[model samples]
Target: MRPGHGGFITVKNTLLHCYCVCGKIEDAHHLFDEFPQRNDLISWNTLMGDYLHVSQPRVIVDLFKEMCIGGFEASVTTVLYLLSAIGELGSYLGGESVHGYCIKMGFSYNLHVVTALIYVYAKNGEIDLARWIFDGVAVKDVVLWNCLVGKYAKCGMVEEAVALLLGGGLVGELSPGEGESDVVVDPATSSLNLNKSAEESTPPKLSQP
Candidate 1:
């Protein structure tokens, strides 16, 4: 009897671990419900991590909502994974919602989670939001600082770009424009005034929305 109990417990634990890694949440939950005891933090986080891993990012957000509604307390690991999944989706709205959750849960101090928040905002074209997150990160690394500057520059914030560049963030490098090519132009095409000829040859087409 003792040998059978030990073997069963080991099998159960192994199955739970696999379920989390493989993102088989429904199966894991079913097994958990059938087991006599299965409410450990590890088990809970494993299930959440699997949900984040297996589902598309948007679906992962829904899973997080379900977990929150179910009154399951989240660990730092779980929140970090959730933030990363949100960033991966590149959805500003979803990231914002998760940010609210993080604030409410007092997870605002987690460095990894904060960095994920910044990356999510930047990827979603919300440089202002990303800067806000970066400001809160204590002793922000040079890489993180560059992310904010580069994001602003990419979004066409010229003055902001210059400011960041002056502050030691590497700004855009000077490169030759398309017009600076060294290849000799064909005589016929070169002699033709491209702008005037294009205008004379064809009128711009209008498309109905």
Candidate 2:
């Protein structure tokens, strides 16, 4: 805690973030390791995020465990990164543990977290659990809607996926027992192979401001 010590840490964190953004992950990691305050949450999160960006999910998971062992309480950003890594690794048990942590820590209601949960479950072939999580959200965003629908489609539940879109589930307006006749399905939608479409579609990113 010298004068301007916090500001110095901020500057270093900024540089680390810049290096990561510029795809210089090694440089970023080097800078992070050199930080006087390795306990800095921003630095930890930034480095972990860069690892995630590089598709080094195991690295991210390792860093997450280190961060936890260091007694740093995870923020939403931290959880998002960890969840994405777990999903990429196809660790159903890890995803479930994180889901429980989110609920315990009061992040389960966050739209981004919920979306990530859906993704992890779907990726692990737990589509039913994903759907259950989706149904619990009272408010929905386009990203969340796309996530669930895409997951269903990816799992070859074409009817469920199509019903979501056609029944206005995207807008949270789907009513129980709503018949397909109430809404018009576009010709393109009718012929589209939802599984293929889902395959080409990228899942929404879990971003924080």
Candidate 3:
């Protein structure tokens, strides 16, 4: 630790996290670019997660592609955050591609990874696949059930959401990495409004007198 610095925080990385959290992505990127070991796996994953912190999902995907070119190995956190970004960005194909990557890398059995998978699939309107993943979980919990509920509600699959709420027997489960477990779903404010078609715009025909 430096003379005025805490044991864990530093000017480059810690400060980079602060900048990213504050939505100053440009500054954070500039600092990350200036760092000598920017390609280091730790540095790369930190920046990727930081991009997620600010909701810049597209850039995070691009960054991961670049990381692949550089031979970087993605940790579970790496894929978790990236899957989240894909869901938010509506990159369904990309999310599916990442799911393949998870299977290839043997991370599919991880509960946190599978939770993110369910969220990503639901957000991408692939509820069948999402429920498939959900079903494979032997030990279900509040986080998993709520993740599905929120996505179903946001996607206007109210029937599915109701079914999940009514049928789910939730217990406690371990929280995933930072920020993943803290999702708050408000259907009115979630921004993915696809329910406009369900309003029954055409009136029923009246019986002829």
Specify the highest-lDDT model's number. Answer: 2
Estimate, for each residue in 80-139, the C-alpha lDDT of model 2 and write its tens digit: 778878977889999999999888987776666777788888878998998888777766
lDDT of model 2, residue 190: 20
Pairs that clash in candidate 2: none
Q: TM-score for each prediction?
A: 0.58, 0.76, 0.70
2 or 3, which is superior by TM-score?
2
User: Which has the better lDDT: candidate 1, or candidate 3?
Assistant: 3
TM-score of 2: 0.76
Preferred candidate (TM-score higher): 1 or 2: 2
lDDT for each residue of candidate 3 in 33-117, tens digit (9 for 90 to 100): 7644433655666677677666677888898888888788776667766776787788789889999998898777666667678
Decreasing lDDT order of the candidates: 2, 3, 1
User: How close is each model in CA RMSD to the real structure?
Assistant: 19.8, 11.2, 14.0
Between prediction 1 and prediction 3, the one with superior TM-score is: 3
- Count clashing pairs, candidate 3: 0
Instruction: Superpose all Cα atoms of candidate 3 onto the true structure and report the RMSD in Å to 1 decimal.
Output: 14.0
Question: Which of the numbered candidates is closest to the native, going by highest TM-score?
Answer: 2
